[model samples]
Target: MDQAREDWSPHSAHWGAFSARWNGATLDIRPYEEDPAPSSILQNFTTAMRHKARILRPMVRKAWLDRSARSERTFDQKFVACPWDEVLDLLANELSRIRTEYGAAAVYGGSYGWSSAGRFHHAQSQVHRFLNMAFGGYVRSVNSYSAGASAVILPHVLGGYEDVSRRNVTWDQVAEHTDTVLAFGGMALKNSDVASGGISRHIERDAMQKAARRGAVFYGIAPLRDDLPEEAGARWLPIRVGTDVALMLALAHTLLVENLWDSAFVARYCTGFDIFERYLLGRDDNTPKDAAWAAGITGIPAATIVDLARRLPRGRTLITVSHSLQRAQYGEQPVWMGAVLAAMLGQIGLPGGGYNYALGALGHTGRRFNAVPIPTLSQGKNGTSEFIPVARVADMLLNPGESFEYNGRSMRYPDIKLVYWAGGNPFHHHQDINRLRRAFNVPQTIVVHESAWTPMAKFADIVLPATMTLERDDIGAAGTDPRLIAMRRAMDPVGEARDDFDIFAALSRRLGVEQAFTEGRDTRQWLAHLYEPTRKALAEAGCDAPDFEEFWERGELALPSAPDDGGFLRAFRNDPLNNKLPTPSGKIEIYSKAIAGFGYDDCPPHPAWLPSTEPPDARRPLMLIANQPATRLHSQLDFGAYSQSKKIAGREPVRLNPVDAARRGIADGDIVRLFNDRGACLAAAAITDDVMPGVVQLSTGAWYDPEPGAAEHPLCVHGNPNVLTRDIGTSRIAQGCCGQVTVVECEKYTGALPAIHAFDPPEQD
Candidate 1:
C-alpha cells in the first residue's frame, strides 16, 4: 500500500502544521500547506523525537532499591530496565505505603507548565487527576515561572490576572492609534516563537512590521539592541540592570514637576496619587526623584530622561514592562511603577495607551479569538489543602514547616516524603542548582514521567518512559490562536514508552482506581469527548467543523472570526462606574490600602526605588543576567540540532560587552568562569557590544552538569546559569522568584574543558 499521509501540529506558540509521511513503521514530518515555511522551532520537531537521549523503557535507579546506597550519588548510579506491569506494581505499592506511613499531603506533585500540549494528555492535569482519584490528594503548586509576580500582584493593582493575559490592547489597535511604544525589557523574539498548546500562525513579527509601517516609534530600553527587531527601527536605550523602577519614578517626577501629568484623570479615576506625589516631590523623602537622581542610578543621561518624559504625554503612548524585570529583588516596583506612569499619562483605558506587563513576551499577546475552553481531566477535589509557590520547591524540600508570606497570607511548607513529577524539569527551572541538588537527596522517593533522560531523570528513583507529542494522538489549541489543530500519532512509541494517559491509567488500575481515573473512556474516546464542546461552539458560530472521525483525518478546525473589539479595556474606558472593576475602590489603586496594610516594606503602597542585593566585593561588579534561550523552550529541546548550533565551544554562550571583555582579558570563544558566593558556572564568552559594560547575558535552560569533586563551589560544566543565580523571593508581598539577581566576576579559564555529558543517558548496568 502507498505510504499514509497525515497532518499534525507540534506544541508551540508559532504553531505550524506538518504532513507526516509514514511507511508502515518509519515516519517523516514535513511542513503543511497552511504553513509552507515552518519556524525553526517547528522544523526541529522530528530531530528531537528521534534523538538518542529518548527514554525507550521504564528504568529504576539501583540506589533506590539498595538500602545502603547513598541518594547523593544519584548521578553516578546506573539504571536497570523493567517491564510495564512490574514497574506499575512497584509504583502503586510505594504510593500506598507513603500514604499509609505519612499522609497524602506528604506526596508532592511536581508537575509544571512544560508538558504535552494536548489538553487530555497534559501531564500536570493527568497526574493531578490520578493522585486525586487514587490517593487522598497531593501538595500542589501555585502560579507559573513566566509571570509569577505579575500573576500574584496584578490582581491587587489592576482587577485581576486577565488584565495582563487577555485584556491588553491588540496589536492592530496599537498600530492604528499609538505613536510611541516604550518597551522596557525589549521584545523577546526567541521566547515568543513558541506557545503552550499550538500556534496556527506567527503574527508577532508581522504585527511589529505593521506598526513600524504605520510610523509608530519604538523605543527599546534594555542592555541589548537586538531586544527589538531591526525592522521596527527601535532606538536602543542602555540602562543599568535592576534600575528600571528608578527611571520610571524619575519620569513621573518630571511629569509632575512640569505640570505634564493628567491631574483631572488622576482625581477622577485613580487613588493614592497624593501619597505617591509626596514621595515623588521629596515631601516624604528629602531626595526628590528628579532626572539627575535617576541618571545617577540608571546610567542614562539626565537630558534624555527629561526629553522622554516630556514626549510621553504628547501622543498615544504605550509602556510595556517585561516579566524579566519582576524576576529580581523588589521586583514588584517596576510593574507597579509602569502602571503609575501610564496613569499619569491619562491612558489607562485608551486604545494603545496603558501599561502592558507582557506585550510581546508571548506571540499571542493582544490577539482576539473565540473563547473556547479546552476540556481538562476532572481533578475532583484536594482532600489535603497544602500548597506552596511554584518557585519554592527547593525551599519546601529543604526547610519543611518554615513560615513564609505570600499575597497577604502566611503558609508553611508540608513535610513531603515522595515527589511525583510528571512534566516539568525543576533542575532547569529552579535557581541555585547546588541547593536543589541537596533538596533532591532529602526525599525518600522520586518518580518522574519523562520522554528523555533529563537531569531530573538522572536524579529520579523511578523513571517511567513516556511518549513524545509526535508519538501520540492529541488535540492542540494555544490561548490566542484561532485554529484547533489535530495532532495525529505519526509513529509508533519508541521502545516500550507509552503516553502519560496510558501510564496513569495503568497505574490507576494497579491502585484499584482505574474507573475513577479514566472515567471509562480510552484515549480516543477522551479526545472525542473533549472535542464535543468545541464542535458545538463552532457550529453555533456558523463555522464548518467535522465530527471527531473526520476532524482527526483532516487535521484542523478553524474558529469563525468575530468583529474586532476596539481594545481589551475599551468597555471599561467607555463606561467606568457601571462597569466597575473587582478592586475595592472600583478604580485603579495607585496606592493600594490593602497592600499598605500588609506592612511589607519591600513592597510599598506605590512604586518606589529599592536597591538590589549587593555583591560581596565592589571591585567584581558585573551583574550577570540569566535569560531564556532563543533556541529552545526552557530545556525541552536543548539536545536538538538547532539548539546545539547556538552553543559556543560546545558550551552555553555568554554575551559580554567588548570593553568589559577587554578589561578581563577575555576573548570571543574563550571559556570563562562566572562565579559568586552562591555558585559558579563555565560558559564560552562571546564578546560584543550588544550587552552593557556592567552586565553579562547568559541564557538559562542549559542542563545542569556539575563537576564530580568540586563541592566547595560546585562548577556547572554545562552552561546552566541557575547554578550561579540567587534563590530568593521577589518580595514578602508577592514572594516570586528573584532569579535575575546575581553579581559575578568573569575570568578566562585555563583548565581543560569538560566534555558536555548532559545530552548522554546514564549507563545501564
Candidate 2:
C-alpha cells in the first residue's frame, strides 16, 4: 500500500471532491475520504490535464485568415498559430464591427458552463458577464439542453424546477420514509455521478441501499434494465421506448376506475382534474387509457400496471421522472403525466411521497439545500432580450428571423453574425451533428475559448486556448453540497493557456471596458470577494467564518445543510389557500388551460401520449438510445485515460440485445455501422440482454470524428450518436431538444476501418 501523500492539493470536480499530487511521473488522484461511493470519473482528471489534445496557444482558421467566405468555414480547415495579443486585437475589432453594423443582437454569446466547478471561473458566467459589460450584451440562450422540456413545463404544472426537485423530498427523506419508488425513467447512478456545482459525497447508492434494506421496493420502468442501482434490488419493467406517458396514464386510469384515487385531495388542492379525467376515462375520445391499452403500447403486462398502481397508494410512494424522458419527441408529456399520477395518488407533500423531477439525474438534486450562502459570480444582465432555447442553437443559426413558438410566445431567431463562445462546447450538446455543422458555417465569425482541440474548437474560426481546472485556483461549492473545497492550483497553466477570467479581462481591456468586466480585481481578489458573501452569512448565523487565507490552508470547509422539510410543495399541501404555487391557478394544474390555449396539436392540454415522430422504418428498425455516457461528462475529457479505457477499438461502444445483434450478424467486439436517414457512425458491438430487443444503447459524447471530405451527413469514424439524431424540437410549446431517442439500424462493417483521429490536434499551419 502507498503512504498517504502529505503534498496532496485538494480540488473539486462535478463528480466529487478529491485531492491530487504528482507522484514523480503521474498524477495520484484520491476521492474525498468521506465519500462512500466515490466516482471513477475522478480518474479522468489524472491524465486529461496535460493530454496532447490540450490547446497549446491561440489559433485562427486558415480559411478565415485568408478572408474566405463564411461558407468555407469548416472543421477541416488548418489552424494557424497566432500570438494572444494579435488574436485578441482581431477579436476586439470584430466585436466592434459586428456591434456597429449588425447591432449586439447579431453577436450571440454562447456558453453552457460545465467547464469548471469554481463559480468565479465558470465559463457561462464569464462569457455572459464579459459580453454584457464589455460587448454591450449579446443574444443569449435560455434553459439547458439536458432539462429544457421539464424547466418549461414544471412551472405551469407544479412550480419552478428548483422548488420541486432541489428543495423537496431529499435522499434522507427517501431513505427513512419512502416505501415504493416508481422511477418512470430509471434513476441511473451514472447520471447522478455529476452535479452542476461540485458535489462532496456520492450518496445515491447509500441512500437506495438503506431504503432497500428497510423493505422498500423500487421498480425501474425503462427499456434498459440497469437504470436503477443494483443495491436497490429493483424490479425491471422493460417498457417500450418513448411510451412512458402511456404507462403513466394507465396507472392513473387504474386508480380512477378502482376508486383508489383521493378525490377529496384532488378537489381541494388541484385544478383541472375533471377536464383531465374526461380524457383519461375516454369520455370524449371513447378510448379509456386503461392498463390493457398501455400494455399494448408500453410492452408491459397489464397485470403489472394494475399491481403497481394498487401498491403505490398502500405506502408512502415517491414518483420520480428522469431527465431522459423529456429529451424525446413531445417530451413534455411524460413529465406532466408523472406529476398527475402523483397527484392522483394524493401523496405529493408527504415526506418521500411526492413527485420529484430528475431526482437522481444529478448529484446535487434529491438533497437538502445549504443553510448559508455559497460563492456566486454575478453575470450582469443582458442588454438585449433576443434569445432562443439552448437546444435550438442550430435552428437559430440556420433559420435567422424565422418565427417559432415557445411556451405560448411567438419569437423570431436573431440573425447572428459573430458567435463568442467560452467554456462549453455546443458541438457536444446539440443534436444532429450534420445539421449543426451546416449551421456553424452560417455565422461570419465563430470564436471559442477552449482547453482542448475538441470538435467545437475545430469548427471555430478563432480558438483561444484556456486553462483547465487543475491549472488554476478556485472555490468549489454547490447549493446542496455541504463541503466548500479550496480548488488550489495543482500546477501552472498548460502550454500557453490562459484562464477564462484573464482572457476575458484582456479582451475587455482591448474593448475599453476592462474596469466594468474585472471590477478592478485580479483572480485572487475576485475569489476573496466572492467568498465574503458566504462568510458574512456564516458569521451572522454564528458559525465559523474562516478568513480567506485560513480557508485556503484548510483545503475544505463543511457548511450547514437545511433540514428536509419538503420545501414549497409541502407548504402548499399543508395550506393550499395561503401557501399557493406560483402557477396562474395557484394549485396543481392537472390539465392546464393555459397550455390548451397554445393549441399545439402535438402537445395537448392534458398529458396525452403522442406517437413518437421518429418511427422505426424498414431500413432503420432498431431504436437508438443516445443517452449520457457513463464514462465522461458530455465529451469534456474523452481523451483522458479512464474514458479511453472504456472505448472499444478506440471508438465508443454500443450495446445491443443478443437478438438484434444476431439478426445483423454483429457479434461481440465486432465493429458495426449504425446508420439512419440523417447520418451514420461506427461502433463496436457489445451483445447484452440488458437492453431490450429492437433497441440499442449508444451513449453520447464521443468526440465527433467525421470522415475527411465527407460533408453533408458524413459518416463519423468515432461513435457519435448525435450524427444520427434529429434536429427538431420536442414540440411547438416547450421547443426543447428531442435528442435522447432516434431510430437506426446496424450491420457488421465489411469495409476498411478509418483510423480514429478524434483525439488528435487539427492540421496546424
Candidate 3:
C-alpha cells in the first residue's frame, strides 16, 4: 500500500466521515513511518522527543480540572471514537454526493495559519494542491491580518504584485537620511517584522535614547504610540484611526497652498501631476479646506497639523505605516494619499523618501530559478463551488448574496450542506468572533484536519488527525537560510493520528482519483516526483548539499540566495510601463486602471477611504479590533504547553483605555462582556493608557470557550471575527478579506453563559 494511505488502519479521526460522528468504533493501527537503517536515530529521537515533551509539557502541570470549565474537547466529554476506514468511506460518499447534487462549486476550501513550518508537509500547501487536483478548484483567499492590508492594497496602489521589489535604501536611510516622516500608523521597528522578531519596547526605548542623545526631532502621527525613540524627542499628533487620508490630504493641500511643493522632482518623474493638484490640492475657488478641516476629522489640532507638515526637513523624508488608511469606511484612501503626500514633496522614488509595506517587498536578489513549469494537471473532476473564499464567508454565509461568479461558475453558498475545512483556522483570524460562531452553526457540516486539536476541530463532525512537522517528511525553502531542512518523523503518533498528506491522499483515492496522485507509488517515490524540479535547481546552482536521500536522512540542505541591490529606489524605472505589474498598466499605478476595469466604482482609480463596516451606531459606541499574539501564529497548534503557559491569568483580557473603561463603569481586572450586534466576548478589562480611548482591542487566537451550555462548545465555537466584519465594501482587489470595523459595548462578565453542542448525525439526534 502507498505509505501516504496505508496509515488508515482502524481507529482514526477520519472515521467521522463514515458514520456522521465517531461512535466508539475501533480498528488496527500501525507505525505510520518506519525508519530502516536508522542513522543517528538517537540524535533524531532526542530532538523529536524534546519537542514532543515541550508540546505536552503544559499537560503535566495543567489544571485540566479548570481548563475543563472552558474545554470543549475533553476526554470526559461524551465522544464516540471510531474506525478510520468507515470515516474515509463516509467522507468520500458525502463528497461525491455533494458534487452530484450541487456541482464542484458547492464545496468551500478554508485555511488559516501555517499548520507546520515544514516545507512539504504544510497543511495549506498540500490542501491547495489537492483541492486544485480534485474539484476544478474553489475561490481561494490567503494572508494574515497583520499583513493582509498590505497584500490587498499594495497591488492596487503600486499597480503590480506588491510582494516583489526590495528597498533601494535601508532603515539606516530612514534614520540618518530622512528629514520628515509622515508616520501613518506609527508602529515602529518593534511591532513590525523589520526587527526580524519583534523588538521589545524596552529595546525600542534604548534605541530612542541613543537617537535622542543626538537631539533628533520626530513628529509622530498615529492612533497609537509613535514608535519613535524618546531620545529623538518625539511629538505625538495622535490622529483618529482611519482618518489618516483626510489629514494627509489637508497636509498636501497646505504644502501646495504655501507653494512649498518640490517643482524640480515633480518634473523629473511622476505623471498625472496636474490632475492630482487640481482635484486634491485645491486651487482657485476650490481653495481647499486647510489643515483645520482635516484636524476636525482626524482630531489633531489644525494649527498643529499644518505646523508639522511645514516643519518637515529638507532631505529624504519617509511615510511609515500607510496601513492606517484601511481602518475606516474608505480604507485605500490613506495609503494612496500617503503616496500623494510623498509625491507632493517630490520625495518619492528618491532614497528613503517613500512608503513600503513593512516587509511588503519580496526581493529575490539572485538570478530567478529557471526551473521548467510543471505540467498543468487537471484537479480530477472532484467537486465544485460549495467553496467561497473563506475570507468572504461573512458575506456568503451570514448575508444571503445574489449569485456571484466563482471559478468560472456562478453560485451561492446557501446549499452548502457540508464544509470540509483543512489547513486554516478561520476562528482565530476572522473578525467579530461572537457572530462567527452563530454563522458557523448555520452550516450543515463542519469538519477540520488537525494534529493537536483546536477550536475548529472540536466542533467538527470528523476530526481527522494529522502529523506534526517533526513527525512527517516535508520540504520547503529556508527563506532566509541557505539550507533546506528535511523534516523527519521524530516521535510516534500520540493516538490514532496520521500525517495530513496521508489522510488527504487516501481520501482522494477513495474518491476515485488516486491514480492522478500517487498511482500506487509509496510516499518516498511520490516525494521524489515532487522534488525533481528542486533537484534540477540544486544541480544548476552547483549545490554541495548531499544527495537528496542523504540530505533527507541528515535533514538539512542549504540553497543560495540572489544578490542584493538598492531595489527600493530604482525598481521598474527602466520600463515602468512594461514592468510586468499585475495591473493593466505595469507601472506604479497611481490610478488603478485594472480595478476600474473590474467595475468597482467604490474602489475607484486611487486609494480612497470607504466607510468601514463598523459604522458607529448609537447602540454600540466603541470600535473593536483584533490583534495577534507574539507566542502563536494565527490558530495553529494551541495545545502546546509553551503557548498555553503564555495565556493571561484570571480571564481572557480585553485591553482598553482606562478613560473609556471608567466612563463605562469598568475597571482594571474587572470581568467585561465585549458585546456587539454580532456577538459578545467574555474577558477581564485591562484599562491602561497604552490603548487609545474609544477602541477596544482583543488578542484573538484564544481557544474558543463556549458558554456553559452552548449547543456547541464555545471552546469548539471559535468566534469568526468576520461576523462583525462586513465583506461587501472593498472589491476583490486581490484576495477576499477586507479591512475590519466593529462596534463594542462593555458589560460585567456574567460567568458561563450556555453550552451549545452541534448536531450529531440525524439518527443520533
Worst 10 residues of 2 by lDDT: 1-10
Clashes of each: 4, 0, 67
Per-prediction TM-score, please? Answer: 0.96, 0.98, 0.75
For model 1 the local lDDT of residue 360 reads: 79
Cα displacement (angstroms), candidate 2, residue 762, comes to 1.3
Rank by TM-score, descending?
Answer: 2, 1, 3
lDDT for each of the candidates?
A: 0.81, 0.90, 0.50
| Residue pairs in collision within model 1 | 12-195, 13-194, 13-195, 15-199
Error of 1 at 39 (Å): 2.6
Residue-wise C-alpha lDDT for candidate 3, range 256-298, written one tens digit per residue: 7788877665554454456566656456446464787777677
How many times do residue backbones clash in model 3? 67
lDDT of 2 by residue, 320-360 (tens): 99999999999999999999999988999999998999899
Model 1 C-alpha lDDT per residue in residues 485-555, reported as the tens digit of each score? 78777777778889898998898888888998888999999999989988877777667867889887777
Task: Kindly indicate the candidate among 2 and 3 with the higher lDDT.
Answer: 2
Candidate of highest TM-score: 2
